[model samples]
Target: MARSLVDLLTTHAAHQPERTAYRYLATGDCDGEVQELSYARLATRSRAVAAWLQERGLAGSRAMLLYPPGPEFISGYLGCLSAGVVAVPGVPPQGRSQNHRALTRMKRLIADSDAKVILGGHEVIAALGRLAEHLPELDGITCVATEDIPDEMAAAWREPDLTADSVAFLQYTSGSTSAPRGVVVTHGNLLDNQRVITERMGHTPDVIAGCGGELFVSWLPVYHDMGLIGPVLNTLYLGVTATLFSPLHFLQRPDRWLTAISRYRPHTSGGPNFAYELALKHAKPALLDSLDLSSWKVAFNGAEPVRAATLRRFTETFAPAGFRGEALYPCYGLAEATLMVTGGTVGVPPVLLEPETGAADAAAVGCGRPGEGVTVVIADPEGPRELPEGEIGEIWVRSASVAKGYWRNTLATRESFRATLPGHEGRFLRTGDLGFLRDGELFVTGRLKDLMVVDGRNHYPQDLELSAETCHPALRPGCTAAFSVDRGIEGERPVLIAELAPEAVGESEKITDLIRAAIGDAHGLSVHDVVLVHPGTIPKTSSGKIQRGASRAAYLDGTLAPVGATAVR
Candidate 1:
């Protein structure tokens, strides 16, 4: 076992210096212009970066990494680890002054992390310089383009003194529920979670050998935990080759994802549930006919709710292309747990619970059992007592893979990371998620804070959202937000905001009526108001998770513009 990622990179460089470590596609097309990096070159570039940081006496400081999708981000990240600097990965500003959302996020991360320096590509650094006047957070920080550092600097690199408990990086939350906070992850947490992923996904030597050696195809953003720890870092952990591309490219043409899988024949690859839905939206007969996915064994889905309909539809749609139903692996994880907490067996189809009475499509999919050395328990959110099986409660986790806590936020750390149960010996991470275990399989229900109680009945927002989305074709899938707003003496009012499809028009009243009827019939609760909005109007996190809290805030402040007159009960 390697002590740190630096050790793994060093060993791989010495043993297989010429082996291609990564290949980046500029256009997200299999036949597009591509760039490849060998182990030796990556090692040299990483060392150069490490030496540069060391020379600047930044061994114990935080360095923000803001780079476009490419190998440069990987090298810069590894260099931070090699130099013992805490790496803070964030999305770079796209040089558009109107992108205030991205700029505001960057500013927030910089302020929260108090990063001493910023490492990025040459172009990214120049773009930051152009916007430096508007960003006071970069006033005293040093900005360096790691690409400009001389390879000769590698000779001056000194191996950082590190251990299992040493803080490696700060992974900021996606803020799907609330304000983003940096989760403090250690080297041990990273390695242990990688081990958990390997074991849970069955990334064994035999599996790799059977699939024609270890290989991966990914377009997930490297800055996100699901992308960074799951695919990219796991590739390095296994010392395998991963073909990379930009997330934007993948979004522009969903066919590229399947095409990459066909070309690379990777043993394991996946993304959030929304990615599969996007692929389904564009699965033309011609594209499906060209795909050969027999070598794609594990398609793990996580980072958000995994809809049973999505799993079934995706499997049936792509089965003609040799995509196996068993390959649709549904798992569960969060940033505070490093990445993965529980995952189904590699060759098993997802387990779906029996649907509630009169609601056949309301079955929840299981997120698999916990990995080795990890314990998951359901406990009441307001107390220390554990909940019985088949009862939904807060998901509490204890494992080596769990992060230390939130960075520089002791109050949150104690509140979220210092949880305890009646007989549990160690602290457990309060995941703020609601789920239940049935027959040892975890079935996530909904977010704890997003739960709504109206007329003395508890309701999960996702259930209402799902009902509304399936009510009409005009309602976009995965674009509905269900939240509760305080109505003074009227108690909590349920509000549903859904985006219309691009081609959907002039039926806002009809669509809103259908959604209300569907919710009333399915959940037996009348919606307080149904607001139909234009496409892409609903707020979503960078990872595509619906932001119910943000949506509620916007609704309360009248910031969300309705497509038509809202229907109020």
Candidate 2:
């Protein structure tokens, strides 16, 4: 039996040493300069880095991996696994700003994990050196450049003993800094989730053979679970090839993603909802004419709320270019569940649920059913009673892919992961997401934490944000945050922070009133505060999900500056 992922790597290296394992597109486009890594070179380099870590007695300890967008980060991460060190992947600091936001997150992760070693690229290592005076905690940590580790060290590398129960890595969610809860993902969790992904997405050797062998193009950040577990580790698990590029490139030109898809003809590719919208924004006629997406079988949309509008628009927009509507796969998952929990059936169009009383466009899209060996149930958040089908409630999951628990946070681990349903003996993972099952299909509604309650009525923030976006053409779509704030004597009231297009910056007050009136007229709830700021002012997580908690904090701290004029209330 295979002991761990390292065992798989060793096997692949021995059998198909010359097979291309990964290809990094430097310019984001397929025709740009490429950096290729074969199975043999990847194994050798990872072992060399492992030997370096072993020389410093870093086994069984946490090693924080800080590398820019490239193949080196993958090698360093795999090296940690090979060396028996817990890997903590984090964003690396860029630019001369010593206190960059990414750097801040890295510092907090370092402190929380108590990592003893730092594996990074040369530029990142130098940047940390420049900020060593400000961050004294990093001074004692041993820093090594994984790319600089000599090949000679491979001889000294020893494969560490690993098992299914051994901790593989700590996947720290975006909002983890405030609460500091790191999900303790074990080797078993990784392998099980990979199997779940394969089975759910129909990713078999047949698809691989039909698509000309393993090919996946991704611009998602490797630090995030979707990027790490979805594409990076899945490639290693299947011994397939993947093409990677920086998220910066995709954002600069969304068309590059589709172009890469057209050139490589990948069997699987996906991103968040905003990515589809961005692609629609830039899909000009000339660009669309050059694309051929027929080979793309599974186009997944996850890591955020998957909008029915987005799926519809993307399908209609790219249909002429051979993009199939059935290829649009909507899935739901979180880092706590490892990566994927429920994925849509491959080669079938997604199902849509019309709203009970609201507008037709307000309908919720089904995120598909639970994967094989996974049980999903909608439970009343107030108690453990399971709710009937079509009744919205907290999403609970039970599967082998569920992670062990939060690292060193026993209370949080038990509260979130050890939830038991009434009359049921098995524990279920509280997903903290509100959704329901209809005809065995899961439909995600909103986050439980971001729910706004007013006049004894619960309202989802995404619903209000959508209302604000559609109320006026000036308000940017998918860029509004709706949250509730406590008023002490008055009670909790709803607040909306919206981003205005450039031309509408001068008419912020008009747009703000329009949004407030629209919400009141539609939802019957008066908006307490409406702050229309410039575009991109609203905070978002790494995966581009609106951070309502962060936005609330910003509002309370008086940090938001409305463009035209508005009183603080």
Candidate 3:
């Protein structure tokens, strides 16, 4: 019965003062130097920061929290909650790169949230000062490094009058840079979602206490909802310990993720589908020689479309290291629902749904059933008409964990968050995802927005991308973008923008022919254009979800500078 996250922290501090609540891997590896924060120390630091903010009369305003990957971000985030400030977690400037996408995102978030104060670590604070002219919004804001705040301020900390309805933080959804929509998540949404995650993922007290009550190891960025709400906040909610590191670390060396999991033997650890693929790509014999993942009960994958190939490959590749197929927990959710909406039953292997139409080999991974107290229904995209269990339609959800609405955007809020289905009593949140429920299990097909239509036939971008990827070794997998572009009088035609594997840069012409033939054979659709650019050129969200809309825009604007290209008549 924790009233708020602050209450959970206080209770944990009182009961397990000396228990390690968080461990930060400084070098992003298990063998590297580490930093530990006990529950008592976390409580004290958060209170001290809270008192500092209260003294400055910033308790009720939004504080843009920018921090590199570590414990300081957690402290600042919790401090904002304790002080009743709406925390806007954002990415900090990594270096002197002027055109850094993360820094650009920070500037946009600051403007969108109108955050009056900026709280971050020392390095990021200095980086912001250097880029102040570019970000005029920071001119009127009070910026301070929370790590430098003294401990004596804890004495002045005073709890605010908070209730379930009080706004706790703002989760700004990614993939939209021009008009960032911040989801207004209340304290109730936070608590409810945590409960859903705990029950759905089976994060029970026995599971927690058995793993030394320290069972989460995450490299997902702290700014994303999956990273913040899933591992970080849930750690406080469940009173379990979490090991944290930067996403860059995992990217630099995917082996580090497995190494840390092996060393810690945590009960839960996972990321998006791409993470598993990355680990498999780099899983040399030497890298996984000493690995052991028997204690990993939940490998929750979400924040993007889960791939059946990734699940099969990861489990097969690591089976010798004690990884279980049942551990591959494919979940589904968005920031609007806090984090997890549905996760497959614990200890049960994921189910794959074969295509109900063409492409006999096509299949999609089942996301899972709706969590406890969460109701999910499939409805037609055009109307509120509820579809049958196995029919593809827009996913609708009604849950206590749903956020209030999008901040300051009533139109979008109404369209997405406030929706009344035909003959339904209560409003449901339109997830904008195309999926269906079969035999009480949820399986996501593709995005309603990213769906491509050609010659009056429905085509999913993921299926097209997967076809192109498997066609040739020259194409980089999971780095392709497929969309339909308006071709004047011809109506709309399908276009493919794929990243060329380094070795394939010189074979673009040969690879382009292979892509065209493969796509034609698979879907019987002619590719209007095929542009192959260098790796990392294609746009993606922070969590590495391919942004098809952005790629389409780039193509229309002639900004898709491909290293090599071809056009088919």
Candidate 4:
């Protein structure tokens, strides 16, 4: 058995040197320009990078990886692991010089992680040098273009001492509900989670053999946990082939995803719920007719709320293309747990519960059962008692896959990662997500911090947002934010902020009225106020989850600019 990911790569390279490990699509289309890296070549490149880092005596230090979506990022990341360096994966600066927002985010990550080196593509490294004068964050940090390293450097590579408890990487949170914090994940945590994923998703030898070997296709951002651990590293874990494309490409043309799936016929491929919705939006009859997704046995969905409507629509729309409803897998996970905590059984349809009274949607989809060796318990967020099945509470997790804690933030690490239940032994990770377990299955409800308590009734913001978005065609899907504002002694009042389509700017009043009525009818709650802003104004995390707290702040400070007229109730 491989002791670490580095060992796994070395073994694969030795046994199957010519096997393709990864394929990159420059344009996200099947026929577009492509790049392939075999196991042997990838191992050589990784060794080269590891030797360079070792020569600089940077072992045990943090190295920030800032490369665009490509196979190079994988090499840089694996190189860090081989060198016994803690890797910090982050988004690279884009555009001509450097985007201010992107630069600011980069600075925060650099300072937070205290990364000593920055490994990026040649172009990104060159741009960083040009702007070094203005960026104080690069004052003492070393920047290297890993692509420029010679393969001969592999001869000088020396294996560093590694252990299961060794820190592997710091995965920063998406900052949807709060500021991002780096989650400290060790080698043991990583390997255990990979096992959990494999067991829960049924990535067994029989399944792979039936599908002609393991394969995955994804366009998720590499900097994010879902993209990195789920599809990318899983490929390496199973010694399978994975075709990757830029997230920007998928956003530009959602149909490219289906095109690649039809062309490659991979056994597993999927993204967040929004991804399925986007694909459905562009599923023209001609496009659907030309695709064959019969080989896709696992269409895993997570990272965001999995909607029953999306699952039903995507299956119905792609049924002509051989997509199965049983392939629609709904799972739940987070950065704190090193990625997957719970996932649906493979080849099974997602379970949906009947709508509760005053529910926003017709049904709630179950996230799925916990992975092997993972213990999930629902506990009251305000108390120490664990809730029984079918009762909503904070989702607490205890597993080997749970990460060590937050990096360099002892207070946060203690507060979030050291929770104790009355009867459960050992520490449990406080997921900060509210959910309930029914029949041994997990059903995520909403973020504990984002849950709105109006008139002593618990209201999930996602439910309210869903109701508001469906009220008007002008309202953007997955772009609505529902939050509660404190109104002194009057208690918490619900507020809705939605992004309006450009052409619907003049219909703010009508849209606002419709949203108010829709939410009131479904959730039985009157809107305190409705603010319709320009498209893309609502705050969202990198993974596309709505930042309800940020929206609430903007609304309170009067920073949300109205597109037409704000409706005050």
What's the lDDT for all of these models?
A: 0.89, 0.88, 0.88, 0.90
Steric clash pairs (candidate 1): none
Candidate 4 lDDT over 1-569, as tens digits, reads 77788889999999999998999999898898999999999999999999999999999999999998899999999999999999999888897434776787788999888999999999899989999999999999999999899999998999878888999999999881225599999988889999998898888888877766647889999999999998998989988889899998999999999999888878889999889988988999999889999989889999888887778888889999999999989999999999999889888898989786634245889988999899999999999999999999999999999999999899999999999988889999999999999999999999998889999999999889888887887787788999998878989999999989898877788888899899999989988999989877887887888888888888888888998666453
- Per-residue lDDT for 280-314 in model 2, tens only? 98989999999999988899998888887778888
Q: How high is the lDDT of residue 251 in model 2?
A: 88
| Models, CA RMSD each | 1.5, 1.6, 1.7, 1.7
Give TM-scores for every candidate, taking all chains together and pairing residue i with residue i. 0.98, 0.97, 0.97, 0.97
Clashing pairs in 2: none
lDDT measured at residue 337 in model 4 versus the true structure, 0 to 100: 98
Error of 2 at 96 (Å): 5.6
Instruction: Kindly provide the TM-score of model 4 when superposed on the true structure, using C-alpha atoms.
Output: 0.97
- Per-residue error for 175 in candidate 4, Å, reads 0.8
Clashes (N, CA, C under 3 Å) per candidate: 0, 0, 0, 0
Judged by lDDT relative to the true structure, which candidate is superior, 3 or 4? Answer: 4
**Which pairs in model 4 have colliding backbones?**
none
Mark the 10 consecutive residues where model 1 has the least summed lDDT: 354-363
